[model samples]
Target: MPTTQHSPQGHGHAHSLAQGHALDRSEAKDSTENGGEAGNMPNLSTLSLDELKQLDRDPEFFDDFIEEMSVVQHLNEELDSMMNQVENISRENESKGSHLVELKRRLSDDYTALKTLGEKCDQLNKKYLKKSEEYAPQHMRELLQIAASNADADCDRHVEHFLNGKIDVQTFLNTYQSSKKISAERKAKEERLGTQLSALERAGI
Candidate 1:
């Protein structure tokens, strides 16, 4: 079976995008709750060293900062779990997709084989029919008649044996019935084949 390549890069990129979107939502909510305008959102990296030191020394500011960091940490852990789930799902999809592709390929091959077999069957049938027309009509009629005659003789023999106590009732019925069935079928076939023979004779074939 052919193998499918599933690069980790694509899966990682997708998960990263999802994590970024989640963080963005969290940041937006934090900004709204703080009653701060988007433009006033401070970039810690842009702050002067003295300004950062001043904020770090403020107890109230530090408490709020720690609280916010805790929320961000929790969100990161949740995002990590989401990323793992997405990775598993991606792997499962790849496995299932590969199996599906193989199944389709096998089905296609089987269908092609069956189509070829069907065509050959049709060709053989046409050839057989042609040969049957060339030589078999009279032979088939004679065979059917002979089969009917033999079946009738077998049926009469079975009945005679039953009457003479050579066979029990059950054995006699089973044998006689089977012979009669064969006789009936052969007689019917002979009649039908006789019609075909007559047609062939009239057509001078």
Candidate 2:
């Protein structure tokens, strides 16, 4: 459809003029000095859409009129949150370090105590072993000597009976030689064993 352009003549758009108080907005904006310049509808036709949007960002124009308290409060809250997080991290790090140090100290003390205890136990065992070594051979020798004395007493009775002449001389001589020879042989064997045993002891075997 073609636009029927209104004219500035007596009767171009009587309907546009006919809208009553709405058109009287110009009259309302009129002050005593300047004509209705302030009341005029903004002629957005002069600016591109992007340029009009940039107008709100102009600090010189908006800073004097806009309320900025909310922006300041938001920034303050963010800074406070960041500071709290940093403080928490520092505290955690300090606690962890202290705990690790304490654990290390405890471990060191435990190790030291265990080492000393082990040394004492080893020394005690060595002392007992030395006592056992010193006592064992002497005890064995005394036991053997006691057994030898008992055997010697039993032989003395038989030798005395033969020496009293109640038995024949030939018989007594034969029995006595045989018995004394056997005893001598046994004593010599025992002496050989004792020498070997002493050698082994001296060699720490």
Cα RMSD of all models vs. native, in order, equals: 27.6, 17.0
lDDT score for candidate 1 against the true structure: 0.84
The 10 consecutive residues of candidate 2 with the worst lDDT sum are 32-41
Best by lDDT: 1
lDDT of candidate 1 over 77-191, digit per residue (tens): 8999999999999999999999999999999999999999999999999999888875676777677788889989999999899999999999998998898899899889889
lDDT of each: 0.84, 0.68
Query: How accurate locally is residue 187 in candidate 1, as Cα lDDT from 0 to 100?
Result: 84
Give the per-residue lDDT of model 2 (tens digit) for 37-150: 433334446667665676567776444323333554566789999999999999999999999999999999999999999999999999999888756755555545555555
Candidate 1: where are CA atoms >4 Å away?
A: 1-68, 138-205
Name the lDDT value of residue 107 in candidate 1.
100
Clash number for candidate 1 = 0
